[model samples]
Target: MSVAGEGAGVDTGTYRHAMGRLAKGVAVLTTTAGAQDHALTANSLTSVSLEPVLLLVCVETDARFHDAARESGVFGVSILAADQRALAAWFATPGRPLPGQMDRAPHHRAESGVALLDGCLATLECDVRDIHPAGDHSIFVGAVRAARLAADPKAALVHFRGQYSALT
Candidate 1:
């Protein structure tokens, strides 16, 4: 077993464990194709540009959210508040039945038909501008179609060391 602070190991297990230490803001990525909706817990969101308003999200290529988002050509990202850990966990769980998967949480539909979970600190709806395959995931570059930022200050739910933490 490698101890903490040990030499950097490039293996998959070692790389994953090392990345776990990096704190990332939590967000639920939502998408819909036709009559069905899909969502997944993702922390790979990053702001790429402000001019023209652009952002990116990395989704596992095999994830259900991926296909829906790809086919729909749009996606929604709801930045989770610290108090919304339960909702985050719910979407992250695999094998959860669909058609009513989003029923557990109250949400509203964006203009693009993507569902944005209510009570989030921030939300963004984007149209997929570009897609790049990266390893086992796809990097989706989105052009911000609509966005909302919470007016009041609040804590954000974060993920670190493979666990969720409220960063106050």
Candidate 2:
């Protein structure tokens, strides 16, 4: 372990240390506002409730999806399969051109008209119910309108320490 503020280590050590201890599952968040569709890779998603089918996804304040989520008022979460490292990377890249960018990814419309990735382990269509302000991020509370799981079991893609990996 490195000490801080005594010429022992860099200031970035704390951030790296914190990330090192966290293990997260990767998911692609998709939303369409008007005629524009937006998708971003995210790991900050969690199930908030089972009784009413609620989920929470955090979006960075500056992310393209942040405003899209608010305007669209609906979104889809696609839990990426283990083999989808390329998809995860493609969505996570910053400043990529957007028109028909993800056309190659197999997708279908959910009940809410949100584009859901076809080969994912699971997909959830949700309506934005509440928005909470978190530091540097917005926590979106969504009520699940529809959900589906793949018929065949598949390993999940995971993200940790800024790397994409597979759950064993």
The CA lDDT of each predicted structure is 0.92, 0.88
Worst 10 residues of 2 by lDDT: 1-10
| Tens digits of lDDT, candidate 1, 1-168 | 336765555687878889998999999999999889999999999999999899999999989989889999999999999999999999999989977999998899999888998889999999999999876899999999898998884899999999999998
Q: Give the residue spans of candidate 2 off by over 4 A.
A: 1-13
Q: How close to the true structure is residue 123 of candidate 1, measured as C-alpha lDDT?
A: 93
The lowest-lDDT stretch of 10 consecutive residues in candidate 1 is 1-10
Candidate 2 TM-score versus the reference: 0.89
Q: What's the lDDT of the predicted structure labeled candidate 2?
A: 0.88
lDDT of 1 at 125: 95
